[model samples]
Target: MADLESGEGKTPVIDIPEAVGVFDTFEDLQQAFYDLRMIGIHHSDISLLANEKVLKEKLGKAYWRASDLEDDPRAPRAHFVSEEATGELEGAIAGGFFFVGSYIAMAAMLTPASTLAASIAAIAIGGSPSAVIGILLARRVGKHHKDYYTNQIEHGGILLWVRLRDKEREEMAVKIMEGHSGRDVHVHSWSK
Candidate 1:
């Protein structure tokens, strides 16, 4: 039951019904999330499937479909990270690379024997590759975070879970999910 009724608050939260689904695309996942919010679903009640790394760490390197984890309450869930956090991470990665490159170049050139032109040349030589590598790595990070939903779809499907307060919200959630191209949209009798 919802935490709405103040007097009957003694009702135990033993089992909670949850709507689950698999989204095939990022747009569908996003639209579903928005629609859920419009329907008064609290953000706390929504969760996404864990990322590839977490899955790997927990389940080992064995190949597994996302479907396998959908109904399992023990399956790990990913905490949502906003676009701002991802952007900051990308900036840090790139900046760290540049800093390391400059430091190493200075370490090699800060000597009386090194001319200004030689020092500058060393910096360019060392820094150029580092900058390129940084860009590539940063791009990789963006792909892992920004495109997470679609990437999960490629692996199997992007799993979404919405805790349902009642039959009405359950129906609404399933409808919104399916309308956005979700498959196997249904409500489990209990949730984690």
Candidate 2:
């Protein structure tokens, strides 16, 4: 099927057929995302509703629902980050802290007056705060993501957009979304 869809009269040309859905919770949305991937949907082809700032700036709306953006090409998109990616980020953060502490400990050990025990103590002391700070920062990252979903839920439900080229893929997308308890799962004539 042609990626670019054209129809007569008042029908704006769309780049591709797109499926959209509203998920009541983040878990449902996440599950649909994974399932869509299993069916050969590219990661870049899936998008969540953009944040309030984007909605306001682009669509001039403080709030919107899945239906509102079903056919609108100007709707903004948000990137999806997998749980594994978030975990990796958290690990990187904590590991970075440890590396810094080790570096500092090594610097202290270079001093003529510093002994092995003192160096060890330096590592423990410096590392403790670094580790603590890192954990806190990582927690903040996790919380920020959680808050994003919560905020969206409060406004309505989580809106998901799946872009596809063919009718078969579009149907699969709609079914996958609906199976995950998606509300208003539908296909549009176009996508951004």
Candidate 1 local distance difference test against the native: 0.79
lDDT of 2 by residue, 1-192 (tens): 324332322433456878888888888888999999999999999988777787888667766765666556666789888777888998899889878977888788899999889999988888888888888988898888888888788777888888897888888889999999999887866776
Alpha-carbon shift of residue 47 in model 1 (angstroms): 0.7
Q: RMSD (Cα, Å) of candidate 2?
A: 3.9
Taking all chains together, each candidate's TM-score versus the true structure is 0.63, 0.86
What clash count goes with each model? 0, 0
Query: What tens-digit string does per-residue lDDT give for candidate 1 at 130-166?
Result: 8788878988998988667666877788899998989
User: lDDT of candidate 2?
Assistant: 0.81
Top candidate when judged by TM-score against the true structure: 2
Model 1: per-residue Cα lDDT at residue 105: 89
